[model samples]
Target: MVYSHSQVQLYKQCELRYAYKYIDRIPVPAEASLHLALGTSVHGALEFLYKEVQRLKVPSKESILEEYHSIRNEQITKIQEENKRSQLDQQQVADFAHMGVEYINWYYSTYHPFDQSIVMSTEEKVFPKLDDDIKFRWQIDRIDTQDDTFTIVDYKTSKRYPKDTDETFKDQINLYGRAIKQNYGSKFKKLIAKIVYLHLRNEIAREVTDEEMEKTRIKYSSIIQEIIKKTQRRSNGDKEAFKPVQWYRCDSCPFKMICPLFAHNYIHDEAVNLDDMKPTTIKAVIDEMAQMAYEIKRLKEQKDSYAKILGNYAAEKGYKRLYGNENKVIIGKSENYSPLPEKKNELESKLASENMLDDVVDIDRFKLTKKFKEHELDYDQYQDLVKKSVSITAQRPSKLKEKEIDEYMDIIGEE
Candidate 1:
């Protein structure tokens, strides 16, 4: 099994999705989204320009811009067939194009290749093997040697810096340091790694401490072991086990139509409605749904408390508001509205009247019951009933821990 930061992130998100993507080898169409294409083109252009500069070729800004334009145009043209008009607007296209240029310019300006001497290597392939049957392979964007230190520089196109401590970022850097040690001899006295958030215009740099590097090795080893276990399980006929975990990204997932959990009637209906909605409108709906879910949770809790209080005052004829205005609300018997028929009692009576009972046929079973007590049924039948009776809403996972954040940052550095 080969592991990368993205693979780890995907595994963390949903093991099934990771399985679908990597283990199953499901083909993903080449993304034609302008924003994604623009990012790729910009990275390509920068890589080209940097390599040229590394060779002592001081190309003018105009020449660099021209090369960027050529690459950008080619990419756009190649994706034009798949480009739905609604997928990207003129303004978005122009904005991404401008962003690509800005990123390239920032790369050139921030790290002047002409002035700096090349040391380790550019786009170096490093594969670190673990005790488990997993291989971690990553390509460094650029590695430079300065005095007694080895600096690993990774260029990022994103505008925001990761919201984490410097120590967390160092773990990622240390992985590169370890990779370097494994591949090259441990001749370098110091190892420095940096993630250049080009859009944010911030370079988060950290030096790997000895203790931190050892921790990184252990962490990577653990991850490798987990990956191997998952891979082996997948290979042993657990196909559905690799199903993509449904997340926010699932809405854009190519296999949404195939996913059993996310491909239900409600999700299908929502997908159809979403196709007709504007992006902003869809976003607004999502926000409203989040608020509604929170409100529902609060309302359910209040309802539960109210039910408890009502049980104590079964003889009472009035309802009282709790924790709000000190106003009393009365519940009176009503004759104007018809009451709903008791379906459970009707079914019970029908079953009793039939008198065709067997050991498995219990008349008392025909009652409205809570879901949690339905464990007598098989798992699949129980799941189906639960799906029909209630809606399952997903909440955002807990915040990334300090150590996890550092590991992610390290992977970003490698990227």
Candidate 2:
């Protein structure tokens, strides 16, 4: 199984999507949103700036902006050529590109001298195996040393700043800091992590204590264990290994056409099968899939999305289905749901008396939690329902901690 904050977070958000992406190796939509474009261009510009600064020369602000423009323009062209985005038009793309440029310019003005620390590496790959079955990799954006402290700097370009209290971002820095500590133990007396908000022209820095690093390792190891357990169960013919957590996120998933819940009504049997596909058949099918992905993205972006308006309206009218150009939209609610909290105990007792307790509930913790909310269950009720459902996850020391792993080599010492 693959491991990264993004991948693990995706599994946590929707395991079915994870299976589609990692297990099935589905090709994601080629057209990126403007937000992604900004991050990519900014990251490229900063990588250039740091690499240049480390060589004992700081480029003029104009020169740095010029590099940013080149990157943003090239990326915009690539995005336009892909024609994968439905919500973003050409003008919006240009505007987002300009926004990135402005942010980079602001970044330059804020850090004009570029003398805070010596940049050791940018976009360095860190492949640290957690355990035998939990091997994975990640990339550190930047690592710089100043005095006794080594700073793991991550450049974040976004309209909104990352929440300082968010564990995801915190864990992200920890992952980088731990990697640095493991590989460059003798080089620095202390290690700290910084998330540079390029858009805001400020950073949120923190010291990733040894305790936090160890906790993060255990936390990450547990997620990997759950993923491994699900995969093993799935291979042994457990069809329930990955279950849907439907929401707006589904609107962005590329494999929606073939996703079990939506496929029967939304897709034809003629959809591409990558396993048996020939080179000649790839382009046309993938292009079509991208179009469908764009359509879904567009619908979701609309103020009155189809899922809400059409599906709900049709269901209200007691219509089982509605027709579009060549597809049928299934209008219905899911079945086998638990009762509302106020009535849950009574219903549970009834089911138990009828010998239907196990057959009546989905029993998956996350799934049950979501189901509980949809049924208007109280918070305490949801907690009670899920108390016994939390699965235990096994943990282990990373291969690096045990000195049974590959070394970072030149990345740790590169100038």
Candidate 3:
């Protein structure tokens, strides 16, 4: 499959959206914004600045600002014409245009004369093949060369600057570095990747090594393989293969009305003002259930908080049972075991070899403990089969007969 970094990121963000876009070939209307116009204008002005430098000509800061303003206004006019309900008013559009001009002026001042390196290309598109069938198609924002070393530079207009240790930006530049090496390996001696944050007026850079590139290749190749396999499964009648991953981006997603994960929310929202034709409405029931669920969650948090306090108090006092006026709280220990999924098959196989898999469901710890109590296995054998940990729990006994409480207390004492 021919993919780009953005396409791969979209797949990782939400499989259902990727399927709707790439697999189903669904067309979504584009929404225009002043922010996008500002970003595009800044990129265009910088491209003009660097391209002029390649010709032994350095454009003045005012000229670059003019280019930025022209680009911004053209886009803003188109956006207003197409999107009547656009949230960008005249003031917002003017502010964004001014911001674009500032970004261009800042960038031009920082890299004046533009002679640090030779410009190889701006907005160059490349197709790099990982294998015979797996390929990537992406665009490099800019490439510069200095003494056999190549630098891949990407422009960012985001308000939030990336941290020094941000892996996402690093991975993107690393991938671009690999593309350059693949295309011009004979001419390249070293690689450097950078993301220039025009808004924040700072940049993050990395020196790329061959070893890191290989690791990145393997990582993304594995993810692409998984996407392919899941796509095939989804095509072959497995409806659950590509499930929706609801996240912050869902609000801006055009496919949310059809996504199984959030379609019900849209339905409920639309039905909130329906006429009350019956004594009990479905919306009312759903609202009540939602409230109940919230209440249950709140109460669970409170109960867990109290349980922790009670458990700690009992431990400090060396008391297994704390008596209240109407109820008694018991502090006890329970054994728990949870085997990793990959280790389950080997564990079950070992148990079957010893003829101890009978009546055991999914390696249930309680059933295994019962078998141990019945003397079906020795202490060492049971311990080997399941590693157990004891956790203290606080339980309150209320509305219980004295005889029932005595029996429960006796059982706990014996254990």
Maximum-lDDT candidate: 3
Which candidate leads in TM-score? 3
lDDT of 2 by residue, 246-283 (tens): 77777667876677754533422243457656544433
lDDT of 1 by residue, 144-193 (tens): 78777777888777656666663444555677777777775466787777
Order of models, best lDDT first:
3, 2, 1
Give the TM-score of each candidate. 0.61, 0.62, 0.69
Question: How far does residue 360 in candidate 2 sit from its true spot (Å)?
Answer: 24
Superposed model 2: Cα runs more than 4 Å off: 84-88, 267-415
Q: Cα deviation in Å at residue 115, candidate 3?
A: 0.7
lDDT of 3 by residue, 10-29 (tens): 88899899889988878986
Q: Which pairs clash (backbone N, Cα, C closer than 3 Å) in model 3?
A: none
**Which 10 consecutive residues of model 2 have the lowest summed lDDT?**
397-406
